[model samples]
Target: MMRGLPAFFAVLLAALLVSPTSARAEGPLVLAAASLQDVMVALADDWAARGCERPVLSFAGTQAIARQAAAGAPADIFISADRQWMDYLQKGDHLQADSRHILARNRLVIVAGEDGAWLGDPAAFLNAVEGRPLAVADTESVPAGRYAKAALTKMGVWNRVEGDLARTENVRAALALVERGAAPYGIVYQTDARASKAVRIAGRFAPRAHAPIVYPAALLKTASHEDAAPFLDFLTSPRAQAIFRRYGFAPAANDR
Candidate 1:
């Protein structure tokens, strides 16, 4: 009886191996920036619906993921919220040079909960939040935060509000602080404001408010050419660009 059980298990395993569904399986682990949550998830799901295996998505600050890639983490792809982190990985020889692509662009915005004050010009905006904690992504390490700081500095309000800043690990968390009314104001990506029902756009920073918000993607060195190539191709594809657009992202001008 024991011998029969072993033979049966071996046959089942062989059948499973040859199954058409398993034969085409590809599992690529993707590490991305936090602000990409809504759009990236939708893109991955769309890819899965088209028959390829869903790529595993890991979202966090670009700095953290850059550190992971530098540490030789098991990642097949990296999509950064800013180019600096991508440049960091490329310098470390952790990315496939030819596969690098600028996928999207975004702008910054100030958001407030339903009852929060409407934002106007920079000086008035600062006045509106005076003595109240203003939420933002951590400027030292987070791309969104750095951009927020740059925008504030550009508008000449950074020095005034610096003391009232409530920095969070990522933009999404900062958005949350506003959503739950913990903060009266939060600076985040325009796309983030679009995604949340709990918040509304109080104002948008000008194009020159800070450096351009760019999202760049690349296959990691540890990713197999066979495993990572398709997803990389799909990212800049018209279909994928459409998904990004639906989520409020501006397609990278050089996307073609």
Candidate 2:
């Protein structure tokens, strides 16, 4: 009798382990820009608890993501940090015109290591520091780099400071240079500066320094998931917008 009771409970426990409710749970779908990692992960957790599948995030540069999608990666969506990359995919016929949408906006900020001195003015940013190197993204491919270059050029300091520039592959990498003290100052998005405690904002460049920064999200033409529609809807939902705003992203103009 004792053996039979133990056997019965074991069978019941096995049945509970394989319950149909547990079997029906699904994982999330995601392909996101590296800069969006912190907020996106939180958003995904909130979504998963609401019966949405947990998102599988793939983080990389927006340009890299666009190229991967164009090359036939099995991504359900692409969240680009800029429109140019998304437009690149669209121009290549890799994304459906109707699937594209501008997601958010960001502001550029000049940041220095926590121990570094403040840059009192934008003009001072152009001069060479005896020991500190200036870091920037590579203007050829990274949107942030290109924007920074344009802004510096507008300020008429590009040529003067170009010699001191330490070009990085991406914005995050540029930020890293400053954070690690490899470079004394870096141009990065405000949100990125906020992400690291090792960095401090020395000053904000005038808005006229560069064109407005915008981030775009889209469903690729080759996305395989039918559930992508719901996922995209969640992204633009108020909850997601709130998350972005909390992370320092501006409300997209098209949100109206």
Candidate 3:
């Protein structure tokens, strides 16, 4: 009877292993990025509904993503808000050399919470908010934070208010600090600010304040998916571009 039981269990295991649905369960295409969270989540859900495998995403500062991918994380794609970090990974031989492409552009804006003090003029804006905590991503790792610091410095206010700056891990974290009233103001991408109704945009920094904001996406060399090429094609499709536009990202220019 014990011998018969072993044979029955083996048959059951074989049946389960051979089941088409069980064998064909699709795994996710893992994506790493910070700014692409909202749009990517929506797109992934839509793609899933259309029979495409839903993508799993990990959002953080671009530097963090670069380090993880460089350390051999199982990331299928890496989308960075800046080219420098992507270049860093590429130079380290962590990315598929040919798969890189600029995917989108963004704008920088200063946002004040609904309950916060008003920022009238650019100069008065700095003065009125003196001594108050202002959130920004870590300048060392986040492009948005670096741009914010550059803009403030260009306006001759960065040094004056340097002590009031509250650094967060990423653009999203900076936005959260503002949204939750932990900080009265925050500097984040226009799209990041637009994603939250809790904050009102004080103003957009002039474009001359910093380099243009651009986003680049690429498939990593270590990606496990066989459909990586098709996925890249899907990312550049008009449908995906429209999704980016709806989320406040500008179309990638010819040079991007």
Candidate 4:
């Protein structure tokens, strides 16, 4: 029998149960990108250790979270993997403008499940990958997939691989496909590859290949929790940045 729910699912369930009129717990509710799973949990735990209520976290694609905010979800905070989604919420007046800021940054990498030196050259890698599916997030809506598409297009290989894609809902899902060998290869964040031992980083896309990977966060305009602003501040603290760096995320630049 299952003794307890997994951490991710438990938090997701908590988030789903929360509504505008419901009695909220003392902690802030955070809707963050799926790519932030491990780091966010660690940060929440660290906050709780400091005599604060742990933030309730919900992880999904940035698009999903942004949509939730647009629908006026009672969540207190939003952290997006890319600025586009954050901008989406801000445009809709869903977030507190002054509370918005860059959180952390990351790099894009190609990961592989099979053992081989097949990624040394993009052309050679494409040839080696011939018919196998290359997993990626949804290029039209998901940030990771959009970055991967830009990188591939810049390398002049997008057309060649377009027909062989295996798209998933989020970056983590793409990483999972590669980890499980359901797809021979995948394009995901460097932090994602670092989080798993099942897949190895085969190559990294140059920063110029796509827009900078920026994680922007803000307190929601609908925020009602007393801990919301404080928790948002905690995320940008040097202590939190250190944890992010430990997980392979780079310090956020003054990109705005």
Candidate 5:
């Protein structure tokens, strides 16, 4: 049995602010990157309206979710903020290879807490944080963190700031740290900066700073529900893609 749009949104909208692990995630499941939370909710809503059974959406760090899928967490669809995680799943035979597609794209940016300032120059901005910690995801596994580290390492500032990081489980948690003024700044997706009223854009990283940022989506081989296919198709449809663009996301090919 499928849930309806209004009911699902009512539950999911509230969970958007809650911790991902604690989220009441039920599914033919869709494990998504934390940064995609807002638009995925909209896409889910639209899917429900179209008479598709609602997907149970579990949001987490790309690595975290990928590990879950690799360890055999039950999911029908997986959307990763970076292609590497998707590849990780494919290598493990966790995905339905034919269903894989690049769904959207985004770029990285530096952000300040509501009380923090955007100084506009990369070197100067890094200097301003001084000895204070900057919020970031886990660089080794989290794509946002990896991109952040890449950008900083390229600028020759990683040596100075590496020990000063306040790492979070995911990008959104890093956003929360900055939003609440607990961290002086954070490296996050431009779209994440747009989603929060508590944070403001300080500067953007050049596309050359890191590997291309892509949101690759795919179906898992273990899904039990028929609803997963319709929801997956809705993701790249004009209607869903428009919702993505409205939130500052680009089509995946834009990065190329």
Candidate 6:
């Protein structure tokens, strides 16, 4: 009986070793910017539907995720809300240079819960919004906030409204502040306002309001998942780009 037990264990080990790779592989872990919540989730589901391992999505502010990458966090992919953070990771040697791709571009907009229309320039909008706390992401560390600050500064209203700002950790949270009436207005990505039924885009910043809003995706240098490269490629595929377009993202080529 003891002799037979050894043979049986050996056969089981061999069977396990020869099993299909898909059975043994886990989904890639994707650390993406918060503004990508809707589209990324949809794409992950689509990827899984094609019999691939569903990617695990982690969303946060660009700075937050960039800091995690810098700390050597074990994620297969990193997608930033802007080029600055992507450049930060690339500069730190945390990203695979060849794997980097500009996924999409976006526009910034001011959102509000109210239904009234304001047909005025950005300066007039700021003047109308005076005294009320305007919700925005952390202007110093977050990409969305930084863009909002740049746009407001361009409109020459940053100094006037800086004192009445309601800052949140991320753009989604800022949106929530407006939704719940914590603030009458919030500044967020165009995609964000589109995703939420609670708010409507009150105004859109001019293209030159701030630096271009670009989303760049890349595999991490420490990525070991078998599906990492494929998933990253899938992000730019026709199907994926279609999904992005449906969610208000511009093509990567538009950035250049």
Query: Quick one: best TM-score, which candidate?
Result: 4
lDDT for model 6 comes to: 0.85
lDDT by residue for model 1 (1-256), tens: 6766665555334423532444554557778898998898898888889877877677778887777667666678899998888888888899876888989999999999887667778767977877889999999889999999998999888888899999998899999999999998999999999999999999889979788899999998878536577887898999999999999999887841
- lDDT per model, in order? 0.84, 0.74, 0.77, 0.87, 0.82, 0.85
lDDT of candidate 2 over 1-256, digit per residue (tens): 6766665564334423332443443443456676787788777778888876766676666666666677666567788887778778878887755776766788888898876666656546655333356788877787888888887788777777777788887788889999888898888888899999999998776767887788787877766666686778787888888988988888777731
What tens digits encode model 3's per-residue C-alpha lDDT throughout 1-256?
Answer: 6766665555334423422343443534444467778887776666667777656556778877777677666667888888888888889998876788777899988888886655656777777666999899987678888888888888888888889989988899999998998888888999988899899888778888898888888888878776566666677888888888998889987553
Task: Please give the lDDT score at residue 45 for candidate 1.
Answer: 83
Worst 10 residues of 5 by lDDT: 14-23
lDDT of 4 by residue, 1-256 (tens): 2543364455455576644422444588899999999999899889989999878778889998887777667789999999898888888888887888898999998899758444867887787666889999999999999999999999989988899999999999999998888898889999999999998988889999999999999999989999999999899999999999999999977655
Runs of candidate 5 with Cα error greater than 4 angstroms are 1-27, 254-256
Candidate 3 at residue 46, lDDT? 65
> Model 3, poorest ten-residue lDDT window?
11-20
- Residues 65-103 of candidate 5: C-alpha lDDT, one tens digit per residue: 787677556567889999889888898988885888788
Candidate 1 stretches greater than 4 Å from native: 1-26
Model 1, global lDDT:
0.84
Which residue pairs clash within candidate 2? 28-54, 28-55
lDDT of 5: 0.82
TM-score of 4: 0.90
Backbone clashes in each candidate structure, one number apiece? 0, 2, 0, 0, 0, 0
TM-score of 2: 0.84
> Each prediction's TM-score against the native?
0.88, 0.84, 0.85, 0.90, 0.87, 0.87
- Cα deviation of 218 in candidate 5 (Å)? 0.6
Error of 5 at 129 (Å): 1.5
> Predictions ranked by lDDT, top down?
4, 6, 1, 5, 3, 2
Root mean square deviation (Cα) for candidate 1: 9.0
